[model samples]
Target: MRSGYSAAFKALLTRFAHDTSGAIALVWALASIVVVGMVGAAIDYSRTVNVKEEMAMELDGAVLAGARFLASSTDIDASKQHIVDTFTQTAALAIGDAADLKISPADVTINETEGKITATVKGQVQTAFMKVLGIETMNVSVTSQANYADKYLEIALVVDLTGSMKDPDGSGSTRIASLKTAAKALIDVLIPDETSDRVRISIIPYSQGVRLSSSDASAVTDGYSQRCVTERVGSERYTDAPYTSEFIGGGSGYMLGRTLYYMGYRLPDLIYDPEDVPEFYDRYGDGLGACPTEEVMPLTQNRKTLLDKIDAMSANGGTAGQTGIAWGWYTLSPNWNNLWPTDNEAVPYSNEETLKYMILMTDGEFNDVYKTIDITEKDCPGYYRRGCTSTTTKTWWYEHYNQTTDSSNRAKSLCTAMKASPANQGKGIAIYSVYFNPTSNAMAEATMRDCASSSRKFTYASNGQALTETFVKYAKEIQQLYLSR
Candidate 1:
């Protein structure tokens, strides 16, 4: 009996030792710890990502605000403090403050030469799950860069000084008044102050054509020898080449065979100053008064001078958009750099560092251009050697060969030339054409649209405010800021 009991007890102990249920329970307990850790880690990582995204957005706004503040504020320390304080407030509002969050004034860097501002925000997020594995926190960082580079800008304002510009549209407000206001506003925005050489502006007011000052005309002549000038001949008419003249002797300092240098000569009726029109009496009532005789202002950084020129502009001439386009291109072309003042010389066409722009405004269709026409001895009056007088006595002078089509075609050709691709004499000129005429002349609109670099570059101002708004819009675009990174 004692041997049987001993044998049964030994068998029972062997079965208990071979059992695997306890091992399975131990394995499940170990797996549970790892699973819980992974789940907590995912939750903590997601929270960190959210915080990082919020921090980045807030930091961008803070940097831009800082940059704008820096631009206006002279005190560097105050500006930097303001930037950091702004970031601190913005980030706290965006995400809960972490113990490691930090943004010092030294983190903000301003590079005036590069026209850039850089700001960085660094912080660490404490991880709940990761801390269990000996990890205390994970780093979170964001950086923002704002570029307000003062790019070298060369702007040509080709505005219509035509008599029609003086006429009040249905609104009872004159287009010329609106134009002056708009142009002055642009000048103010672009120049801001007179200290910077990064920007320069040239004014080319066009009527029957662009009026060259006596000095400019003489500059085109041989040693100031000639005064009588003619339009450009052959393919040279479409180019910005300086006018070439042959000296006709008489000590009269008269220049003949002079092709159109600066948009042929201004007509008689367009004379804004009485002192300027020596032959006003002869040409009075000749056609529609005359073209403007106002002197063109070359690229200049003087804010006062540019504003004064705009204010002094008067309305008195027929429309000649083609010549306006030509002079606009010439104003920004390096080929004609010698004609401008040394301080405002044009950069080379291949210069990628500079930007060239043309803003052409017109209130009427292009109607006048210099064309050779046959005139009889009686009508010639001998005082005029080649061109016809702006008078009814010689109606033949008014009717030049395809005057209407030719003038419009000339405008189109100039537009094409100005916007020509990288090839040819095309210098990547950005043309912005404004048609202030309220009336819908399909042909005129089409011509003006074709003149623009793109549809966005063309604007139609139905009223005075619209015109000003258009100019303000363009000013902002020309002097805009961007984010590089």
Candidate 2:
């Protein structure tokens, strides 16, 4: 009976092993655990990746902020603390409870010599499904670097002080007053410390013309008495050529006299024969009145002088934007260095260490011009018989010359020339033009737009507050921060 029981048990075991239905169920049960673990691992990995991307973006922004702070702050410890705090706060807001983020002062590295700031951020995300696979957490790390380049800057602020600037803006503040506030704000940013020589600014406040110091005016005009000067006429009209006392009328007379008399200045009785003067010699009258009272302030690191000059600005006379543009270029052109004080001389165009910029602010159309006319002996009884008769036998005379179209054309041409970089040398002058409520003058708006280095550089401010904000924006742009990695 025992032998028969053993045989029956063996036969049952054999039948169980041969059953395919139960075999398939056993294999599927074993594989399902790995499949579920893989899916869960994938989901956990995706979550960690998302958190990593968020941390990277936030860290980039934080590093940029830190670089900017470092540029302005002398205390390295404080700047590092700012970066840590900013990254921590931003990561918390971005990743929330998804991960445990870590960033400390040690993680931020600043290279003062290279003007670089680097930051590293780390985060650990606890895995849910991956925990079953013996993985408790997934670690992620990111790094970002920023470079604050130390490049010198030379800026020319050519602002319009035309009669229209006296008009009230949308905020009930006169345009001139608003401009003063805006310009000072800009100065405060660029020239934070009075002794900083890395950045220099030249202020050219213009109405119908730009005013020079009596000495500078005399130097440019060969001892002309007026402090005001206009655009040069000739091949060098659009160039920043150094002024000369040499003659332009075939060496017969001094170019100085021609430049002065052709810009509506009445020649002194001692210099020219009164009998040779034409009947309409004074037709344009004296144009010195149209010159702005605020004189041009050459490249200066003195913030007080610049602000005071802007404060002294008053508006009267038509807009002669071309003249303003010409002077603006001269202020930054190394070719005109002879006229400026030795300490304030402009850097050479071949200087790769410096950047040149021009900020042109206007609120009206360019409608003023000092148009010249050549009067020969035939036109006038003795036009050039006296003072200017030796060579050309022709005298140059000027009038207010209300030619808006020509004035606008000249302004645009000057802008083009100023924007072109010196051939095979240093960088070009970047022009930033601001038009404040120029709704009535399409020509003015168009000219300003064309003058800007790029379409994005052109700005329009509808009110005083906007104008101030625009100036601040430009100042920040000029002092830009870059992400190196």
Candidate 3:
């Protein structure tokens, strides 16, 4: 039996060991193993691909964060921190396993060009199954950038409703009427949302000065007394609007009209009453009340407020733009009190993400100002050849020239200060100055240009149509600045 069994085992071994005859089965077995290995590899490859995709997405987020940080500040360290933070957050979300593995991440490269930021990143992901085949890890990378842009904006419109704005339009519509139509159109473009506090506009209709709404007027000072617009039969100022104008406060050019960008706005209660004369004169620069026909309204985000104010605006009063400019700047300025959030708490200024701006329009030259004849004559440059021409009190043309040295200097100084003020220094607040029906007796075009943020920002309108277009153009430019960061 032992012999027989040994012989049988030897025979079986010989059969299994046969090279030619048994080779086919061996080949078949090996082929099966190969197929199984391929299948397993496919599953692992799919998982690795998914992991790579997630990593790429995470890298994208990291890049965007870096770009946003750059947009907010010029600090390199801050941007780096933002990049790292973003990458870390994304990495956490992308990493799938609880087991720690070696991770190699590329350094964030920030490329700033032409006021834009671009970010690039690279990283390597370890593979679980693929590593068994001598592959240690998979390489993955991605790049992305944010425009670092400003999405929304806050604009303040300080319009001159003086008699000049009433100049008849060639289309039969008066300058004021066309202005209203144009202003309404501007509002349509300005407010993506009627109630969105995203952007707020304050309308100041002034002849000699701006008139705040009854609410604003009462708050600034004793509105019951010294209110110019409500009481003055000829005044066109809107009391409900923010008090003051660049001109009224003793400013010149658009400097007197653009009070919002620099001085910001002051509450009515803070200013003294104008009607009280000697007692109020000290603080009278705040501005007068609106005429019976004067439009009275406060800083409102509603489209209706702006449209209605434009419609109700009527020409009256002497143009005192100095006070107007100071007030306009006051309302929008960060320095103002009680005008901030109702909770008296600070909020992140988002769309205000970029800068603030103001568009000032006037139909006529500064005919009414605050300085003496000698001062006006000296400051007029070439514009006031009549008044600031000489120091003599008996000048022949000084009386006819309304632009006083005090007002001219005030406007110039206001412009210089507004553009250079700390709050507005880098705000890039562009001032567009429009002088309609420019007279040789008034400030020259060059002087007007000087009153603006720059030559590129100032404009002069020789006619009513030009005046309308000028304002429309100003609105368009400001809109672009708001839309593009």
Candidate 4:
């Protein structure tokens, strides 16, 4: 009887072990399902987040367009419909047939009294694997608001017209050509209808120096004949101080002599005979004559004038970016308003109703800087006696001119002061810098980076198309008034 009981117990133990193995297998199968479901949920969540982010961006764009339209449109219902239509089209392009995409005219609100437009977009993205976990769809909703503040804008487009701009961009087009096209497009958007007194643009094309009208140059420098001028020196170098006679002579002597030398004429005391001078002088090589032929256009509301100035731009000179930056500030400075036309005067820095912007664009380094020298009797004894008979002392004069600080440093200093003007209630000029450098010029990039108001205001373009796009983007941003969440 004991042996029979043992046999039965052993068989029962064997059956129990077999059942335990089957139970372990069933548990693992259930865990596998759970693991797969978790992974699928994670994927669906990621996709939903991406779609939502895209929707948010698209919504922001839609509202910006709506706000711009509302600024000009008198019909509120029509503007609202335009906003809805714009969203639908952009959504189709960005989200690609999102489930239950919904944007109606009611979703866009227009406040005429406040000059504001707000828009909302709602949609759902169908889930693939989350459906198994009872989440059939993920909802996405985004709202964007824009204010058409109607504030006046004073913009300076400081462009590089250096010799390198003659080089072909990545798209096989000259940089100057691309720049003109892009700049004209910007003018079109900002000063639409050519009758907008609310927006004024100044074109400052600079090379080794910025060109002024001959009369303006003379006025600023107390009879400096050259149309081009370099960076100012002394206490008011970076300030928007009125160009009075006291400050005008600080840098005028050097400019006067240099301009005369490059124009194939010598100073009255140095020249033996004025009739011997050539009518034209080749002013390349040493960058002495590296002044852009394109003269600066002061703040103007005329779209045609702005466009024409850009079209007439020709590139042939060294890069003097500091001069460009200085002129950019001057154009928007109220102190220099007297230099411009009465109707084109810049609004005061204290004016809360005006927004000032400077777009500083360059393709290469700030390699040119003006130097000053005091030539005395000892330096040129013959000048006091018989005067210089030939160009024998030209090279010597060039070498003796005292060099100033680094051009890049000067440019950055000007940029800093412009962005932190003491006069504008602590809110100064907004600077946007564009570096169109396909060659990856590190120093140029660094200088431009330092010049921008913020990281978001700096842009780099490696090709002609990209350069144009950057200009257009900044133009749109500048015209947007103000945007918020």
Candidate 5:
């Protein structure tokens, strides 16, 4: 009986041990499967999130690109296409250029609503782990918006239509023609508005002198005029001669115009007065005014008229950059129709709304200089050659006709005068200077650069295209600023 009981106990214990072993093995297997499944899902989920994030970033960049293109776009479909194409290209490049991630539409449409540019980018990003779960792709959609800046602009184009500009040799009929194209391009970018006259453009073409329209003469003063006299060779002593105009008092100084140099003569001088002569210098030659023989026109905005004048510009005169720059300053001056417009805030010219700026361009050095030389009985070189002689100069019989008293120094002085004008205090004006076909007159370049508001504003354009490009850029930049303001 004892042996049988012991055998039964051993059998029961063995059976219990086997059952526990099988149950433990099954539990271990289930736990391992759960851990593996969790890890796999985590990896897949993280990948999808990462790809979505990347897609979102790509879409954001696309919106900005699209908005820029849209700014100049005149049509909607074209703008939208540009946005989408950008998104597709960037999306592909971002993901190893994989075919899996792509904007099916390949075009994002942008709309301007309430003064904002808005765009939407849609694309599909293929998932790694999600694909194992039978989900091969995820859609990404993003929207972006950029606010528009100012819209009303006032633009002033300061161009160089000087004698040198008309040369086929200097810039090949290239300067004026390129100027026309660039000007037209700038005009096209004007983005006009009907709600309010949003943009106003003024064109100023200058060379040795700036020619103004007769109509604007009523608002202009003799000080800003680029006139002529019966100019001829002479020393600094006979520089201020009073000569009668071949035409009349319209202007008695600009006898042959800046082209006087080409005609083998000197620029005319103002008449000297005993009171006009300073110990060494005087502002307006004699305190009265220089004797001008050339036609002195005033500022003009008329398109056809201005264009015609520009077409007729011939290169023949010495570079009087001072007068050219002065005219530019005059065109931009708020004091045009007022004595002291800045102080009289109540009735200042409306043209002052835009920023005052000037672009001074020159190919040659300064040739024209005005100084008060009163040849009294004691200082007169000769009876007729002593005082201010209009028709001729002492040099006609004595010195070189085109002899300048240090032209380089004269250019520097003129530049300083323009920059230091009472009306241009605290840099009230922005200046852009160009050195086109410069001579050995190093001071000429220095004077222009020093007077400019920025180094970027100074340029050395070799050809006509470059010459026109400088001014055209100024016009466009001003146009942009004007429209924005």
Candidate 6:
């Protein structure tokens, strides 16, 4: 009986071992390990993604900071270090105790030619749940780029040297004085020193007109030593062409009338050549003061001379903004390149290679001009030519030669001509206009606004401080070393 019971128990254990019903449980237990691993991997990957986003943001901040330093700082090595330190600080703020963050000098590149900065960062984060799956860490990397370049600049400053500029600008300093200071400040920023040739500046200080050397005026004609120049009679008046046959009377030229004779102290022919006087003035000397303003300084790199010229500017005449505009444009016009020194000659207009700028500033209205019509009649009120007038000094040639036009319209017409023509109209010159504390003459202000290349380039300064600020802003804009990515 004992042997039979043992045999039955052995048979039951054998049957249990062979049963397939428990196979599903073993399969499910094995699959659970894989499922847990997948979930852990997802969590680890998500954490890594967040870290990468933070790193991207931090890198951008770092590159921008670095690029700004690169733009303004002359020390490239110092600037690069500053950039790295900035990046490290930014990364630390986002990831505390990130002992594995790595950045190398080789990862940062600055291309001066392209004016760009590129930075690359790589790092690793130890996995938490992923480690259970034999994954010890996840790798993350980010890259960022920025642009910073300084371009070439050519600028012409057309300033009003009218008598009004002598008036107070409500800032303790006179308008002329403030202008000198602001102009000098601009020079300091643009040229800095004589070594900086990236910028060339020409200052055209105008009142009634732009004064030329007596010699230059004498060379324009045979007998007349013209001390003043009027707008050409027709279309040529508004063109960039040389002032050869463009004067009134279809360039018949200003023939000195019969009645107006010189005073007791007969000056040089260039100074006061009468109708009968021979044209003795030549072109080899300084300007004849024909269409006179302070002797204009053409586009020049001489910083000291420019500053000294500005210091010597004294305000004393009527406003002839058109004359100032004409001279300023001439300084930038390649057509008049022969009139300047070879090294200081104006560059021709280009589709992309060159940039030309003109800044016109005025404190009052346009109220003066050389002449608007041909002279056929006139009379001298006094024996001295200086005391003559159109009404009282009427001679047969008086009204004919003394004709005048609306000075404001004359200025506008000149501006229109300057801003028109060229491959891209107005592209040849980027015009900037400033009206300082204008009063009563809304028309003058409107004209000036229209003269600007666009409304965005116009500035109205109500006080001396504002004017100075305006000049500083202009200098910064002219020094356009912008950053790009």
Task: Score residue 141 of candidate 1 by CA lDDT.
Answer: 82
- Model 2, span 1-485: residue lDDT tens: 99999999999999998889988999998788788889999999997888888888988988887766654445678778888988888877887753344433328988877878888877678888977778887888889988864567788999988778888877889898899999988987777655455678999988766777756765776553336667776778877778773211111111223444454432222233222443433443323235677888889878788878888888876677888898899889988898889877889888876788899999978876654456544333233345444345544434244667888888989999888857215447899998997355688789999999898888889888889999988877876777877
**Top candidate, metric lDDT:** 2
Weakest lDDT window of 10 consecutive positions for candidate 4: 394-403
lDDT of 6 by residue, 166-248 (tens): 78887888999889988988887676655344567899888655555655444433224354433443567677786554532
Ranking by lDDT: 2, 4, 1, 6, 3, 5
lDDT of all predictions, in order shown?
A: 0.65, 0.73, 0.50, 0.72, 0.46, 0.65
lDDT of 1 by residue, 15-56 (tens): 999998999999999887788778888988897888878877
Q: How far off is residue 412 in model 6, in Å?
A: 1.8
Q: Sort by TM-score, best first: what order?
A: 2, 4, 1, 6, 5, 3
Writing each residue's lDDT as its tens digit, candidate 5 over 1-485 gives 99999999999999997787788899999887666656766776676567767766776676655444433334556556766777778877785556666555444433344445555556666665555456677777656655432233333455555444444525445454555654554444443222123334455554334443343332232332223321222231112121211111122233212233344432332233223345322432221223211233233323444444444433434444444454444444444434223421211224333344555666555554432222333323331233335543332211013334444454445446445543323444566777766233566567667767678888876665676576667655654321110
Instruction: Find the 10 residues in a row with the least total lDDT in model 2.
Output: 247-256
| TM accuracy, model 4 | 0.66
List RMSD in Å for every model shown: 9.7, 9.2, 14.8, 11.6, 12.2, 10.5
In model 6, state the lDDT of residue 426: 42
TM-score of each predicted structure versus truth: 0.64, 0.66, 0.47, 0.66, 0.50, 0.61
Model 6 scores worst on lDDT over the 10 consecutive residues at 394-403
Clashes of 2: 0
lDDT of 5 at 111: 38
Could you tell me the C-alpha RMSD of candidate 5 in Å? 12.2
Regions of candidate 5 where Cα sits further than 4 Å from its true position: 1-122, 125-132, 141-155, 168-199, 218-316, 337-353, 370-427, 438-441, 468-485
